[model samples]
Target: MADRSFLQWPFFEDRHRELAKTLDAWCADHLSVDHADIDAACRKLVSDLGAAGWLQPTAGEVLDVRTLCLIRETLARHDGLADFSFAMQGLGTGAISLFGTPAQQDEWLPLTRAGKAISAFALTEPQSGSDVANSTMTATLDGDDYVLNGEKTWISNGGIADVYTLFARTGEGPGAKGLSAFVVPASLPGFEVVERLQVIAPHPLATLRFNDVRVPKSALLGAPGQGFKVAMATLDVFRTTVAAAALGFARRALDEALARVNERQVQGAPLFELQMVQGHIADMAMDVDAAALLVYRAAWTKDSGAARVSREAAMAKLYSTDQAQQVIDKAVQLHGGDGVKHGQKVEELYRDIRALRIYEGASDVQRVVIARQTMGAFLGGN
Candidate 1:
């Protein structure tokens, strides 16, 4: 109903089309969980998604970017929190999926994939949200263990996560070079959720503290000085999915707008009868299609064996997120005062879309990445 035509694009295979159809049906039935208890809702969503086998693609050694994008887009269309839960599962354990030792992967991927355990990615510090080089969290090597002492804020699934992929300074050098990644369990003696952060959309976010929490050397994800590489590699795989999620929100917003325009009467006719309203609808549809193209282009480029689609992914995320904000704004304006009211789909979407533009590299950050990549590409005579 919401344009399955995109699935037929050359970017996707038959299996991907089947996946979209099957998951859309499942979401319509199962994703309507009560959000009165937000954390509980997210937990149940994860369990349901995992039990349904929708989470299988997340833990595979060789990830398919197209499949990840497709799943996120579908889940986000139905419910944003469902998207959040699934994305966190992949993101929190991404380093393990990509670079963990066989034993490390064996121990955690099963539980996370099965939804028996939740995971968090601990990268951002209070003082270093966008500046990874400024991270001050220390993980000192002491014999067979690394003593972790630091804080991570704005962590998704913070209080509820059973495990965390933590990044800390290990003194290999300075700034980003010295950072190392580790697999940290929440059950460690010094790991604590210092404060639960309440954001506009109300997901389970918190600030985590580690006071001399010592983990075995085996907890390291990659080489001692490879945390920055591990984190960047993981992000390269997941960033495009963020754009897909934004596309989903925009698609839903378009659907809501269309329904409202056709049914809501004004001045003795349907609201869409006005030429001005028709212009808004046209702009919204064009934005949706444009965003979809960029989103899938990045996914396709990655799946086609590009080593790193950082430039493509950044472009997709930047364009799709910014356009989605504009598209959703048109939907909100078309709905009149009803759009601003609590519990409205448009209102919820307004909040949900805002964070996408800010997180996983902000819109401004993406621009910088794109510009630098473009400049380097040109200078290389390619």
Candidate 2:
């Protein structure tokens, strides 16, 4: 009922259509995962998702953007936890899928795809949130291994990840070029989850500390000096997925509000019949559609062979996330007291949608990215 027709849009191909149909059926059968034990639930979801082959779309011989967006958007609409579980698998190992050596891919990707191994991307540190270049975590060469020392905060799947695609400072050079990406195993002696962060919405997040964690040189992803580029490239691929998740939240919020409005009574009539209420619904609907466009457009552009989708992804993330917050708020307003009531679906979404806007490149950071990209494009006479 929430517009399965998006797949019929020109942005998608036959394979994408097939994926949407299959995932829609899968979501219908699988209910929202219980989060009484969030960690266990996530682990279960990951295994289940992998078994179902949903993780396959995250990478491929031919990466299909429309299919990825369709899967993410559909999953997010059904259950946020499922979306997170699926997304992290793609993100944590994305660098390897895109740029890893054949041996590296064989070692990690199969396990990740099989849900036998959980993954995390360790990039943000206590001192460097959006300022990735300022990360002070050091990975010093010691014989055949790199000795890691520092912390990564705000990491998703932090406590549970079996493998981490970590970035650290390898040289004294300024800016991003001196950084490096490495595949770190959580079982290593010096790596520990220092502190588990309790967020408004429950998920496994933590501050990870690496004190002399030794990683084999074979674990290095890409080249030592190419870490920044690796990070950006990985983000460029996954950021659109973030927007897809936000769009799904908006869609669910709209659906929930519509259902409530049609059933709830006002002055001797249903709320949907009221003119002011109709206006809110109209705005919410428009926002949802606009967000879908931004999300899918970025996905399509990137998959269609754009070198970098920075501008498109920034717009999608900024607009979809920011709009999702507003759309969910409006839904809550319509539901009134029950909206904010404990254990309500919209209530949970209200909290969940907040972080999407803040993480994976915040709305403010996206504006800067868009403006700078636009300026560069115009100045270059493109």
Candidate 3:
């Protein structure tokens, strides 16, 4: 089993501990699924997670970052797809929960939290992945409605999501100041899923084309020129949870490696008895603990009323994801032939952990963010 001792750290409270225990029990009972039809699997997982009330934190007014991290970590330990299902629900509706009007919240949050409707975040474009300031999607205001025309690629829950929190250029100025956030429904005319993306690890992803989709003025989220701030704020909250998920994958790899080594024999002795094997285990253990410490430190900082955790969150994500890749690779090395087998847990983990480093924010992009934040703080003298 994955270790639970980390939950005892002072970073968490009694309620956080209780949340971890409950979600762990629920995931054990319900997380196993056939991922053959990935779209259907994601839909079902979202419904199951919502029905269990585990998704409430995603849409609630005051998000508990620690609770969100605990849930992602636990679900990820059980199934990566389960963790994906939960994360998308939160990300898809994060804008609404954090900055939507009361009317918008009433309409979407309940349905999204209940899993009656799916949600997606459509911020990345073909040209812009980490560079939000370079987005080219256009949302032109015409009378009381905004006419949206552009394509959003690599959108999670693209075709399946009932609604999307979309970002587009709404003004003439250059860079981030010209952007705006909007809530667009999938059913709107001219909005279509043009392609379903296939990846090494299957999930519901697609390219969305917005022809002349018109959304009422009420669909705008926050202010017309503040999309960048809205997006950054939302990322600051969820980025650390990505580290938590990586931590889960690493922990599971360690657990599988431990089990394999204890059972497998080498010349009448258990494989784990070998000094080489012990050394590998030691490295894996140290990396896992270190990643856990950084991940929870970021989570606790956000939960403690810090306005933005840009630096802490970036460091947590960069360190945990990069280290998890190493930990998983070592686990695979320890597994010998079985590690590369298609159905092996370590094999799946190798695939799952790769995308964590590249998505949300890539490891390289995170490094830039960390450097900028550090230099800015040092220059500001506080």
Candidate 4:
């Protein structure tokens, strides 16, 4: 009903089409969750996703960006928390799946892939969010262990995760070069959930504190100084998936608008018959399709063996998220009073879409990335 035609695009293969169809059907039947208990809802969603083998891609030796995009798009369209649960599983353990040692992978991947454990990527701090180089969390090496001391805020699954792929300053050099990545279990001594953050849309988010928490050398994700690379690489894989999620939200908004305009009467005639209303639907449709194109293009580029899809991913994330916010706004306007009223689908989407533009990389940050990359290529430096 939402539109399966995108599956036939050249960016996707037969396998991707099948995945899209299968997941869409699965989401329709299984994505329903109680919003009153956010933690329980997220945990159950992750478990259900794992039981159905949907989280298997998160544990793969090589991340399939296309698969990640397709799943995120479909899940977001159905349920926001479902998308959050699935995306965090991939994002939290992404560093491990991409860089963890054999023993590390052996210990974590099975549980993560099976949905028996929740994972978090602890990178954002009170002083740093997009500015990874400004991170102040320290991981001091002490004999066979690294002692973590600092705090991370706005962390997805912060209070609920079983394991964390945490980035901290290890003094290898300066800025990003001095940082290191580690796999930390939530049960470590002195680690605490300082506070749970409630946002416009409900999901399990919190501020975490690490006070002299110790992890063995075996927890190091890669070489000590390669944490920046690890974080970037992981984000490179997941950023386009962010765009896919935005695309999903846009599509759902359009769908709700279509159904509303067709059924609602304005004066005596159907709202859909109005020329101005038709213009809004037209713009929403165009934005959805355009965002889908950009999302899939970035995903396909990454999956096709580009070492990194930074510029492409940034563009995809930028255009898709900004466009989606606009698209959802249009959907809300077309619904008149019902759009802003609580419990309406479009109203929920209005809340759901605001974060995509701000997270992973903000729209302004994306513009900087795109411009720098374009100039680098033109100047023969990239």
Residue-wise lDDT of candidate 3 within 195-216, one digit each (tens)?
9999888889999999999999
* Candidate 3 Cα misplacement greater than 4 A, ranges: none
Residue-wise C-alpha lDDT for candidate 2, range 14-66, written one tens digit per residue: 98888788898899998467889999999999999989888877655556667
lDDT of 3: 0.93
> What tens-digit string does per-residue lDDT give for candidate 4 at 310-336?
999999999999999999999999999
Superposed on all Cα atoms, the candidates' RMSDs to the truth, in angstroms, are 0.8, 1.1, 0.9, 1.0
lDDT by candidate, in order shown:
0.93, 0.90, 0.93, 0.94
User: Can you tell me which runs of candidate 2 are displaced by over 4 Å?
Assistant: none
**Candidate 3 has which clashing residue pairs, if any?**
none
| Winning model by lDDT | 4
Better of 1 and 2 by TM-score: 1
lDDT of 4: 0.94
What shift in Å separates residue 351 of candidate 3 from its native position after superposition? 0.7
Can you give the lDDT of residue 123 in candidate 3? 92
Error of 3 at 293 (Å): 0.8
